[model samples]
Structures are given as structure tokens and as C-alpha cells.
Target: MNSSNHSIWFYAVATVLSVALGFFVASHYSTSEPVYHHAQLLPQPRALPEMALVDQQGKSIGNNLWRNRWSLVFFGFTSCPDICPLELQKLASLLRLADASAKLQVVFISVDPERDTSARLREYVNFFHPDIVALSGSNTELANTANFFGAAYDRSVIIESKLFSVPAGIDMPVNAGNAYQVNHSARVFIVNPQGAYAGSFMPPFDAPQLWGDIKQLIKQ
Candidate 1:
């Protein structure tokens, strides 16, 4: 081959090798990525409204608490019959399995503020995960917070052998004993370290699946 031809061939070979190397690296990273089950990454992150809330220790927590670390937030009441307990237990197990260095934070925001006081929430949350933070506020505060996340709630009271609506504005059905329940969507919100809504995990969160997804976030 002529010198010019040889130079061109050598350059082509180098370029091909470089491209191959890049592909290999990319593939390796992709395969090593942790697999998440039942959770989808948001197309674009959404912003949260400014709402005031108090933590287990009565510490103010809201958008400000979201700063500095990733958080997994859930909204439920202490009186929740089955779903709340099950979810909390599963999360506790996952936390135990996750690496200590990862230090994932979990927040339980109570939708039933009428029954979920700061003290009650603290005690309830501590039973499942000591590291978990329980947050609750007055009815007005909670309503504002819930509205920000589009969470709907309603109160059903039994009066004079029939169910009647109280002054409180909630979105639930009427039931017996004035013991009404709040039905809300189950979404495990994943917030980025910068307090941005990273994504959300829907439901049927197996421990392994959650661990994998959370591990991926920790690495990121």
C-alpha cells in the first residue's frame, strides 16, 4: 500500500477500536445497573408546593426537609387497617437489607391528621423503622399538603341512624360508627438529593425490587 493509503487504513482501524471500546464500557455499565420493579422514572421532574409540616420531634419539615438527601415519602394514616402496616413492614425489611452507607431516608406523611398526632405518629413509625420520620400537621396544614400532591380525603360521620357530612370537606364514602376511612392513591415518591421529585414507585413493591431500585439511586 502507498504511504497515504497506509495512513488512512491505520486511522480507520484506530477509530473502529475506539468505538468498540466505548460500546463495551457502555454495555457493562448498563448490565450492572440495578433492576427496578414496578417503578418508572419520571419523564420530567415536577416541583412540590411549599407546605409546612412537623416531624416526629416537632421539627419543621417540608420542602426544606427534602434538601440534602434522597427521600422516599408515603402518605397514610396510623389507623390504616392493612395496607399501611404491610407497606411499612416491607420497607423496614428493605432498609435492613440495604447497605448501611447508602442511608436512605423514609418519610411517612399522615393523611388522617385528626387521629395522627405527632406523638402517635412517632410511636407508630418507630415500631416499623427507627430511622423513619413521621410527619403530621393540623387539619388545615395537612389539607394544604395533600392538595399539593393531589391527595384527596373525606370524612363520613354517622348521625341519627344515617350518615351525614360534617363541616370538614373530604372525598370519602359514608360508613358506620362515624368511623370513616380515607382512600388515597398509593405512590412511593422518590425525591432526589436536591429536593426534586426524581420519580415514583407504584405498588406491589417486593423487597428485592425496592432494594435494587434504591441501590441504583444511591449510586447515582
Candidate 2:
């Protein structure tokens, strides 16, 4: 073949190969993950960020506290009149349906550290179920853990509004007056045995659905 023709052919082959490689990489990266109804795997499950908090026993707690068993974690305060109670009640009911020796743990992490002392939380959790673990931490630890789970809690600082919202056990911050209240996300995060976020269940939580999902994860 002529030199000019050979050169053109070489360039064409290289261009075609480059295009193919690009398409292959794009396809691999753009593939959508499977959708799970209750608890599914993340495309890339991230480790729980470092945390240092206290448990219902006032014992130091963090990610290590979650290492051994499957944990269903909720972030709220005992003073939360409705949402927290309802969620824990549902969780208790679900646990009742499972074996007492099941390798699952329900954790209630307090967002309002100022009020949910270890003793208070211990008494509070018992009202729902004896097995439930109510956890708390310093404000910094609580904030870090919440951020890892995509939850938020901010004490209202406004002094003179007539809005009435506070956790059930907590009085409004006196310095902030009546407008201040604690606000946090209402979602339960499921952590698998590997201590990775397996999935999450948001409210309007159906006990049957949660049960089914938990069963699926257990068997897996």
C-alpha cells in the first residue's frame, strides 16, 4: 500500500479503538443500580464516620457499638411527643415478631443531648421496650453522627414566637424562650453486619414492609 494510504489507515484504526474504549467506560459508569423497596445496597457503601457518644448506660459509644449486630438507628429525643414514640413503638412491635435472640438491635440516638441524659433515656426507652437502647452523646458527637446519617438538628434561637414544638421530656430552652425547639430528621437507618448502611426506611413506615425487609437482610 502507498505510504499516505497506510498512514491514513493507521490513524483510522486508532480513532475507532479510542471511541470504543470511551463507550465501554461510559457504559460501565452510567449503569443504574438495582432499586430495593426497603433495604438495598448502596452503589458505594461508605463507612460510618468516626463518632464518640454515650449509650443508655452512659458508656462511651461510637461506630464500634454497632460492629457486631444489625442496628436500626433512629435519631430523636425522648421529648419528641409523637414521632419518636411512634417510631420506637413500631420498632418494638417488629422486634416482638422476631426471636428474642435475633441478632438485631434497635438504637435510639438522642439529638437533644442537653435533656436526654443517660438515666432519663434509660427510663424513657423502657417505656417502649426493655431491649431498646437509647443512646446519647456530647453535642459535638451527636452532630457528627447525625451528619453521617444525613440527619439534622438545630435548636431554635428565636425568642418570641408562638410556635409550640419541643420533645416530650425536654422543656424549651429558657434562654431562647418559647420559639426554640429541636428539629431533626425522622428516618431509620439500617446497618448491616458489615457495619455499612444497608438501606433506610422513612416514615409512613409499614411494619409488615419493614419486617419483610429485615427478614431479607437477615437471610442474606
Candidate 3:
């Protein structure tokens, strides 16, 4: 071949090789990714916001508590009539299903700070799972933390023997005299070992499916 013809052929072969290499790399990485059956993995992990909260043991904790282990976090209150207790039970089941060596933690952040003191949170969560970390904080602190996770809550008020409407799907009895309730998000947030907001699982949770997803994430 002439000199110019030789150069063109060489460049064309290089381009083809580059394209093939790109595809090979992409395919290899894609297949290696863990598949999740229940947990929704984020496109990118998000950093957690600074928070000041107290755990059930009255110990001060913050974003650092999320580091070093995978966490399943739920937002609710001690006085919640249905969703809160049911979700906590689901988390307990997850912990039970996890292998002993699984570095997983369950966190319950109480949105009803006025009623859910550190002591009250301790008793409430211990009933469901002794290892569950129950956290309560001042309204401002709680709001900031919840907002970071996209969790939301509101306190129901009793006005002259009339109970304000609770969130739909929450069953609050009319005769809950002088007892107010909290309406909050039921989705369980997931935190990676690096303390990043990784993903979430929506209720009604299937314990076995959740376990499968968690194991896959742990392996990754």
C-alpha cells in the first residue's frame, strides 16, 4: 500500500479496537452489578447531612453513626397506631434473617419528639427488637434529619374532643382520648457502610425478599 493508504488503514483498525474495548468494559461491569429484588438502589450514593440526635440510651449521635455498617432506617413514632409498629416488626424480621456476620443495623427515628423521649423510645423499640437503635431529638433536629432522608411527619391534634384526621391507611380510634398520633412516611431508608444515602424499600415489606437484596448489597 502507498504511505497515505497505510496510515488510513492503521487509524481505522485503531478506532475499531477502541470501540470494542469500550463495549467489553461496559459489559463486564454491568454483569458484575448486584441485582436487587426489593431494595431500590440509588443512581449515586448521597452524603448524609449533619445531625444532632440522642439514641435510646441517651447517647448523642450524628451522621457518623451511619458509618462502618449498612443501616435500615425507618421514621415513625411511639404512639403511631399501625404503620410504625408493623414496619418495626418487619425490620426485626430482617435482623433475624440476617447472618450473624452480616454487618447490618436497624434504626428507628421517632418523629414525635414531644411524646417520644429517649426513655420512651428505648421501651418502644426494645419491645420489637432489642438491637434496634431508637433515636429521638428536639423538633428542629428531628426535622432536619427527616428532611435529609425525604421522610415527613405531622402530629395530630385533639381539638375540643375532636381528633384531627390522621394520614390515610392509619387506623386511629376515635376514643383515643387525650392521646395524639403521628403520621409519617413508612418507607425504610438504606444507608451504605460509607454513611451515604444509598436507597430505600417501600412497604409492605417482604422479609425474605429484603434479606436477599441486602445480602447482594453486602456482597457488593
Candidate 4:
């Protein structure tokens, strides 16, 4: 072939090789990614809210707490008789099965700080797993964190009190009895090492599926 034709042929071959390498890399990357059965991975990660919370020891934990490691956070109150405990148990199970090097942690953020004191949060969360960290904050701080996580909770009300509406400009009755409950989302939030909202494992939780997802997330 002429020199000009040889040069054109070489260029065409190089382009074909580049396109093939691109496809190969993409396909392998996709296949290597762990498939999640029950977890919902966020399409776009979100920045975690700036926070001011007290740990079980009454130590202040700022936004820096969300940094350095993966956090599995659940929002609920000690008074929640069922869902909170059940969800904690599931998380505990996943922790047991998860890879030891995954660098994951669990957090219980109380929505009822009026009742869930730092000591109270510590006791409640530690019952589920010794590694689980409990957090408490003022009502405004708690509400802001919960709103960021898409967790909703109503004001504490007496267990036996009838459903009543508060008039505009009125505040929720804070003296709700010991049996008072703060309804909240049972979903577990995943925060990445960079302190951003990563993804979550929704209700009807499966420990094995969560374990698999956790392994994949750590790889990410």
C-alpha cells in the first residue's frame, strides 16, 4: 500500500482499538459492581447537614462525627415499642455478618431529646449493639437533622391521648407521659466517609442483603 494509505489504515486501527478498550473497561466495571437486592443506592449523593449533637457521654459531636467512617443512622425514640427495636436488631445482625474491614458504624439519633437524655440514648442504643453510637440534641437541632434525612416524627404525645389537632401558633404538648412515643422512619441511612448522604436500606430489612450492599458500598 502507498505511504498515505498506510498512515490512514494505521489511524483507523488505533481508533477501533481505543473504542474497544473503552467498552471493555466499562463492561468490567459494571459487572464488578456489587448488585444490591434490598438497598436503594442514591443516584446522586447529598451533603449531610451540619449538626450539633451530644453523645452518650454528653460529649459534643459536631458535623465531624459524620466524617472518617461510614455511618448507618436510624432516627427513633426509646419509647417506640416495636419498630425501633426491631430495626436495631436487624442492623445488629447485619453488622455481625458484614466484613470486618468495612469500616461501618451505627448511630441512633433520638427524636425525643426532651425525654431521651444523653444517658437515656446511651442505654437504649447500647442494648442493641455495643458498637452502636447514640446521639441526642435539642428539639430544633433534632428536627433539622431528621428533615435532612427525610425522617418524620411528630411531637411526643401521651400514649392514651386521643388524636387531637393543635391550633395554629400552638406548640406540641411537651409533658407527654413516660409512655409517649415519637413516630419516626425506621429506614437506615448510609453516610459515606466524606460525610455525605450515600444511600439507605428501606423497611422489611434483610440482613444478608444489607450485608452484601454494605460490602459493595465500602468498595465504593
Local distance difference test values of all predictions, in order: 0.76, 0.76, 0.84, 0.80
Instruction: Name the runs in model 4 displaced over 4 angstroms.
Output: 1-33, 156-162, 165-175
* lDDT tens readout by residue for model 2, 54-103: 88888887677678788899988877868888889999887777765557
Q: Mind giving the per-residue lDDT tens digits that candidate 1 earns over 1-220?
A: 9999999999999999999999998998787754667667776767777778888887887687777767787878888888889898887787888787776788888877667778889899999989998998776777776665555665556666786654323433433343766665577788777777778788887778898887777775
Measured against the true structure, the TM-scores of the candidates, in listed sequence, are 0.76, 0.73, 0.78, 0.79
Task: For residue 16, give model 3's deviation from the true position in Å.
Answer: 23
Between prediction 2 and prediction 4, which has the larger lDDT? 4
lDDT ranking of the models = 3, 4, 1, 2
Candidate 3: count the clashes: 0
Q: Which residue pairs in model 4 clash with each other?
A: none
| lDDT at 59, model 2 | 89
- Which structure is stronger by lDDT: 1 or 3? 3
lDDT of 1 at 173: 40
lDDT of 3 at 110: 83
Q: Which candidate gets the maximum lDDT versus the true structure? A: 3
Cα deviation in Å at residue 11, candidate 3?
33
Question: In candidate 1, what residue range of length 10 has the lowest lDDT sum?
Answer: 167-176
In candidate 3, position 7 carries an lDDT of 100
